[model samples]
Target: MAAAIKLASDRGVSAIELVFARNLFSLPVVATWLTLAPGWRAVRTRRPLAHLSRAGLGLGSMTLNFIALAMLPLADATTIGFSAPLFATILSALVLREKVGRHRWLAVAIGLAGVAVAMRPGGASLPAAGLAIALAGALGTGAVNITLRQIGRTEGVAATVFWFTVISLAVSGLGLPFFAGSHDWQLWALLVLIGVSGGCVQICNTASLRLAPVAVVVPFDYLQLLWAMLFGWVLWATVPGPATLAGGGLIVASGLYTVWRERQLHRSHLPATPTEL
Candidate 1:
């Protein structure tokens, strides 16, 4: 994803234009997969409004995150974006009425502190606009997570992915009139690669949620920070500063602890199986 965004930036495409390219190219492939695998009926849902809301938030999240990426260092953008899980925890408490223990609450605070550290207040290194947009994108992502949990109870992964893609395409297409411009063949190829890889990533993400509880799977997502750093260094010669390393470390640790605590709580509530005489 970092590479794709860099390619878009190099190609002189606006964030919205890249999003438009991604959805426009991805729609047909997603539609074809839906048709062949589960038939077109797989896209049907009893909750069109829910899907629409989720998609709208998702599109907003993607646009903001991409814009942040374009304007900020990859490591900074990726590290700050890690706050999404923290936002999700808070949203789950508010929206789903889920009980959050004191430990998790403390962890959330620590995670947020990490974000503050990374922001490096009064520092010249941070891009204020990019950081703010990245945080907003993370909040949008958290909201999307809540909606996905709600709709995932009855919606198949195929349907969820397909509907979101359709909605994203429609919304992004609306920006075409204002942002549309020509790209050379190489750029076109890169855009197609971006779209395809993005679809694959979405599929994997949806599949992980389906196979395991979010608490069990989400901690692994922090791996993105490493990938971001690598891509930043290799492609743009951007190095991670002390603030990024320190703050990102705290955030990742706090998030992992929260996931572990959730798993322990879940285990304690399960009915114990016994084989002893």
Candidate 2:
């Protein structure tokens, strides 16, 4: 999805246009699922406000990411975006009031350091604007993660995915008139890939949060950095700079530690045997 965004933006699609195209094309895919698997009634929701907030946050994250992809190296943009997990860890402690042990705190700190390293502040090598935007996108992603968990408690996974996409589609539709453009066949193909991939990802993301604790689930984002790096090379003939590699390494390690620590903590709290239960 990130790659397609880069490809489209390179072809002169503005970030807003990409957002609208994503939701516009993806809406049908989501609607198909809601119709066939769960029936249309699955989308019934009483929480318009929560959905609205989600739509806003989701759009913010997607827009920032799309812009970052245009301005930065693909690998660099992706690694920074993957910083969402670190942001999620911090948010869980402060906003959710979850007990954030020193281990997780340390992990979050290291992960942030990774972001700084990858960004390489005070360097002329990369665009500072893109770095800042990518980080903000990551922050937006973290906020979305927390919001999804809250909504998932009361809403079914299908409803949560359906409403966010629907709301985002509507919101982006309103903005489309301002950014409208005629695309050639190539750009249209990229937009289609963006929409389909984005739709599949939305379902996977909502289901993952509904099925697991947020911390445990979000840390898997680290794996994306690897794919991003590979795609970065294939699509653009670009290899990550030393700073990006160093920073990406830290981000990956921090994510792994966060996930491992969560699992360990969960194991410690579980009863050892049926007799204990």
Candidate 3:
């Protein structure tokens, strides 16, 4: 997705247009699923406002992240986006009234510190807009998480996904007239790939969570940075600089700690075994 966005931007595609294309591509997939599986009833929702809010957040996050992708190196943009977990933790506490233990709070602080380390403030190479957009996108991601938590209580997963894609497509498509850019066959193909890949990734991610314990599969998500780095080097010959490397390391560590703490908390809540007694 990052590669496609960057390439599209390079080829003069507007951020709005790029996201519009992606959502447009994704819409049919969801529609096809609805047609073949659960049908229209699957999209029925009692929480229209909540779904709308989540879709808004999703749009903001995707758009800002795409813009950041255009401005920053692929790895840096991708790593910064990982801060979403940190932001989501805070949102969970504030919005969901979920208790955040001291350990988790400390992990949040450490995770933010990792972001700061990655930014390398006072350095000549800082791209302020890119970083800010990425950070804001992460925060938007947190909002999306909070909204999803509420929506998930009453809404089916298919409903949430369908509404999100619809809202994203409508909002972005509205701006397409002013922002859309010219694309030859190759660029057009990239845009299509962007949508298809985005949908596939989302499906795979959802499937992973459903099929296994989240704690078991989530850690593998951090491997995205490794993939981003590899993609960066291979596609653009862009090696992660020191700040990116250091920052990415801290972000990954902090995220892992957060996950570990969640798993520990989950374990603590389980029925005590007779052996322990």
Best by TM-score: 2
What is the C-alpha lDDT profile of model 2 across 1-277, one tens digit per residue? 9899998898888999999889888888898888879888888888989988888999989899899999998999988887898888788777777687899888888988998889988874888888889999999999999888889888888888888888888888887888879988988999999999999899999999888877789888888888888999999999999989999999888888988888888888987988766
Clashing pairs in 3: none
TM-score of 2: 0.95
For lDDT, the strongest prediction is: 2
Global CA lDDT of candidate 1, please?
Answer: 0.83
User: Candidate 1 lDDT, tens digit per residue, 150-246?
Assistant: 7788898888999898889888988888987888888888788778877877767776776765444655778899999998898889899999999
Off by over 4 Å in 2: 271-277
User: lDDT by residue for model 3 over 1-277, one digit each (tens)?
Assistant: 7888898887788899999989888777777777887788988888888888878878988889899999988888888887777777787788778787788778778778878887778874758998899899888866776666677667777788888888888888898889886778999899898888887665555445444432334445567899899888998999988878888888788778877877888789999999977
The TM-score-based order of candidates, best leading, equals 2, 1, 3
lDDT of each: 0.83, 0.87, 0.79
Residue 25 accuracy (lDDT) in model 3: 86
Residue 114 deviation, candidate 2, in Å?
0.5
Q: What C-alpha lDDT, on a 0 to 100 scale, does residue 191 get in candidate 2?
A: 96
lDDT at position 128, candidate 3: 95
For model 3, the run of ten residues with the poorest summed lDDT: 209-218
- Residues forming the 10-long window of minimal summed lDDT in candidate 1: 210-219
Candidate 2 vs candidate 3, lDDT winner: 2
Q: Is candidate 1 or candidate 2 better by TM-score?
A: 2
